[model samples]
Target: MHELWFGAFLTPTAENAHTLMRQAALAEDVGLDIIGVQDHPYQPSFLDTWTLLSVLAARTQHIRFFPDVASVPLRPPAVLARAAASLDILSGGRVELGVGSGAFWDGVAAMGGPRRTPAQAVAALAEGIEVMRALWTPGGPVAFDGEHYRLDGAAPGPFPPHRIGVWVGAYKRRMLELTGRTADGWVPSSAYAAPEELAAMSAVVDRAAADAGRDPALIRRVYNVSGRFSRLAGPGFLDGPPSLWADQLAELVHLYGMSVFVMAPTEERDLKIFAEEVAPEVRAALGREQRQAAEPGTSPSATLDESSRPRLPKRDLAELSPAQRERGMHLVRVHDGLREELAEIRKGLEQVAAGRGEVAALRSLINRLTMRQNYWTLGSFCASYCRVVTTHHTIEDERMFPALRAAQASLAPVIDRLEEEHEVIAGLLTGLDAALVAMVEDPDGIDGVRDALDALAGALLSHLEYEEQELVEPLARLDLDV
Candidate 1:
């Protein structure tokens, strides 16, 4: 698959936790695959990285979430491991643990610590990784002996439901070698090195992977294009447009065999437009080789839509009609946007009640904030929809209902039935949230979301239709608030 991982750079400082949740929900709607936050201590624009991630795990589904790079030298390795594991469990294994050697001096100063030398930082990082891995591996009493630290018979962890992939942020030779030997993936930020320079490090990583008896191919290569300038955009924008940028980036993939391209958009609107315009072409080009590799021996499935032209297997909302598409947009905004966030908060509380630690505790707070924001956003949508419904209902109540009541109340029974359906719609939201909580806590929770989605679709649509029936004619009779 040709996968382009993209995220918006957000922090608890500028947008706050609630904004992050809303943006994440929006990101999912716009077809972004991942969401990330930065870890910077002194920067007012930065938030506590782990806290944000743990909460994101509980809130989002399908989209991968992580810190761009967390400071390994600043925190205790065991604590980091436990936190990462909890996040993994909560996110259903969508957590990508991206770690780096240490903090920037300014960040270290902000945290009241002295910066380590490159050698010291690398040693600390390697030791931290060993400790983290040991803690995560299933079993009691894990041990690690390293130059910087030693652990004796430390009890093995609250293991993640799935293996938490380890990504090392590195650019220098030493870091690259170490990453190749141990990392599940490598994240080379644009701030660290140019793409061409990073490609040179890739060869060293391949060699180190061989030395470590690991599959070189298994180590995912990711480039974080955070501050990099691209020549791909409209006239007003700084970077280039998608087609031109894709052609340039494709050179990197074609020549250097890079795997993951994470475009961290400097501007909000630019990123959305970029994904909409560029993602498909990049996806198609990347998959061309893979598909060609499979084409010779495989029989392809049916490839036509109702019109008989070749159909793309997955299509985004942009492809749908305005009305049909709006419903999906509404559903995504409500479910991912708010309802699920509230559910994550509830789960965090449950975890805490059950005696879960810092990771679960902090996550709960983030989820609560995010969910409340979702509700506010949802309320806006509901208020708009309700205005129209209520205005229509008022006329029916004053005029039509009385006439019906004089004849037989049963004549307007459909209106009452429709009002009654609201309760069912409301109940489904609560039920769906519960299912999501279950999904986060257990492997079976995923099945719950699937079942709940089905129940919700029927319940919600019925409620909408019933409400419209009672109001549409009555609404036309008056200059409605809607």
Candidate 2:
């Protein structure tokens, strides 16, 4: 599983310098992993990104820093390398390098930087990467000749204290391919690469990595995201409560394998909410997901023979209206999500003994930032997920099932069976909640949690499949407002 991270994206504006600095410190204090200050040197309102970052790094104790994609066009590659390495050393190796093939050509040209065509920009960035790497390496001297850049016997100086990750902010196909082939990580902003756009962009990176004989997994995926807080859910992404934010971010990690989330918060509350609430929830959710990933396709042991499950009379789906078919499939889709959650519970049970993993060992030694994440994951997280399942069951029992039963008399046996299973599932959820509390109280109480989760997984997954098989057609035909 990819190691997880949460960061804040602070805009380095001259007017809000102190405010942004406080946000950075607060991010560290509240257990965020990194702080990224954006680079827009040509802009009159902005303070230099590197200058602000250096000050913030000196003020804070643990949190790391990065130029949220440096404007490599203006800064020569060799000089930029030395400056980055110097900061990494001074900051005790808490620096990463985020590079971009220059955007805003007019602004770049005004800043006395070369204005290149797209192909030229790509070629220049590639060569710039080579120049930076050579400077970072502990070689005697560096000599290179290229169309865009030429380095002649440039003595490699003060090496970085740690291996800094070169994360490229990429959007275009060629740029994405460059990220896969050369960069240590890929950094994409939600503003440019929206959630719907990630999979296809990531595919480009992965394909390029494969063709270049590199392990795609080795290249980290970092996402710069922004969202708002609303009590009621909205049509757009991340436009809901902190819980919604966590769930959406967790889903990104699960589906697309992007592990690092650098939030471009619009306000200080946004930063606090993301750091205090959202990040921990994402970690906890991800722990369960990673457990499932460690052992793929794992589910609870079956308690019922699925062959004996009842099936409702079927209608030819081809004959149904498109809207009707979609309405019927809605129930099936909801059940699919439930089944996926159940599968995580079962897989997580197997690794509960090693739940804390290596982190638990160090947890006693230091209250490290990363340690706190493990604490939340192994302790407080399970109850939230359990509560979710319980709520789902409650909703169905209180609303959907009753509506279905009233809508169709023929669905009585199936509904009766389903209600019986819901009761069983509800009890299992209670047991899981109890197990979570027990595990927290006594960290070694793996057996109780395992047994509870195992029982729940078996009953829950079986029930969902049975419900889908028995009800999809009925819902299509019944056309009730369930």
Candidate 3:
């Protein structure tokens, strides 16, 4: 499967044309893959979809441009094909065609387009696909005779610079089948199709692809998602923090095979959050899952191997005294805090990377504000995190380790190993601290800080995992203070 792709779906309204263009530029700047504008040519307030896309293509350098779902009624497939190909050539293959059968009968008719039944619409779309493919092919003249469209002696030229994907915006069974059989991708909106409905819809496409002797995986699944971001989370889907969006989108990729997420944001900040926060985390989560799936004897919840080490005497939780249980709870709570802090430290590092870019034009202003605000803020947060980790380890070594060893003789070796690992982590923390200090002295030392933090993260995370695996149950069983 392809790695996840992210795009922005912006409204192509005349009133917000400038704002939309700015958002498109920002999307490219922030590393979004594509920019899609909704097509509603009949709507007086909306800009012509193709024209808007062409303009966006000219303005942005790298981002792909497409209509969210071009109305085939307003856009004849033969002409649409030529327009898409021309744009693709001009933009150096930065165009994807997202076409729909048709919608809004009254509006389409008002635009001097044919209004047909559902069956006729599907048939017309199928014929349109045929006509468009013929127009894109390198041939002398194309001749297509269908009930909906016909092209006799139509000259084909100006091929797309790349194999442009024909992603169909599909929801119905016939459209889904057509998408599986002909289209290169499937685009669906979360508003129209809920997450719970995706599995069944995907199954329809999969079966159709299989019946047509095509690999279902070859069909790229793209979802047009819209949601809210808030400091406070709600019960509804995607109405929470970026982390929740990441988790939900990752599940869609892993379970439903929806690899491309085209976010339809109402606010500008949501776009940045989607690109900077949700996208990367979803990629990371999917990467981890893929790696684990590829590895033999690996499970999602696999714990550290402790067979070689001495085993502590087993004692049921019921057998534990209330005081011992309370100690175990304390240990668990402290470990949770450490884990959360480690995550925050990593997030801070990400912020540093995101902000590390050329500021030559505003070098003076950036130096003044960044050094006084952004740099110090991150530095303080990281320093506090490091201190917390160090304190937790110190308490473990001076208090918990001795107590556990004295109570249970078999745990002595484990205590010794943990203590040794703690020393290693302490050294890593010192290195990280030095790196942060260097960053304070020289602003360009962010790279060095990143490297130091990475090293620390690897060692610290591994040590924490091993410690938790070896200590949690034993701590609960033994009469020792955490």
Name the regions of candidate 2 deviating beyond 4 angstroms: 293-482
Point out the worst 10-residue segment of candidate 1 by lDDT: 302-311
lDDT for model 3 comes to: 0.77
List the global CA lDDT of all models: 0.58, 0.76, 0.77
Q: List the candidate numbers ranked by lDDT, top first.
A: 3, 2, 1
**Model 1, residue pairs in steric clash:** 230-240, 231-240, 232-239, 232-240, 232-241, 233-240, 233-241, 439-445
lDDT score at residue 199, model 1, on the 0-100 scale: 65
lDDT per residue (tens digit) for residues 1-482 in model 2: 24467999988889987798789878988778888888988998999988888899779766889999999998899999998988875675578999998998999999899999999998999999999999987658889999999999999855664457899999999999999898889999998899999999999998897677665655789999988898988888899999999999988887777878999888788878888889878877765653453221223222443334554655544455656656776876676576555545444454444444555554655633444344346545566667777787787778877888898877887888777777666766676676666656665555666656655664666576567656766677676765
Over 1-482, each residue of candidate 1 has an lDDT whose tens digit, in order, gives: 11335555555565566767776776777767676666665566666787777666556555677676777766678888988877765554467788888758667767776577888888888888889999977567977778777788888766654456788888777888889888988888765667658668889898887677564655667776654345545442224657766665666666665656676655466567656766666556655643353221121111101111111112222233434433433322332333333333333333332332232564887755554444444334433433433454455456654554454444355545544554444455455556555544453344444444434443443344333323322332333232
Q: Cα deviation in Å at residue 250, candidate 1?
A: 3.0
Per-prediction TM-score to the true structure, in the order listed: 0.57, 0.62, 0.62
Q: Going through the candidates in order, what is the number of backbone clashes in each?
A: 8, 0, 0
Per-residue lDDT tens digits of candidate 3, residues 1-482?
34357999999889998899889989988878888888988899999998888898888776788889889878999999999988976675578899998878999999899989989999999899888888877769988889989998999855654457788999999999998888879999999998999999999998887677565665789999988998878887788999999998999987878878999888888889999999988877865764453222222222112223333434433355645544554555676577557656666665665666645575877654675467778889988888888888888888988888888778888888778777767776777777777777777777777656655654565566456546755776665545
- Candidate 2 or 1, higher TM-score: 2
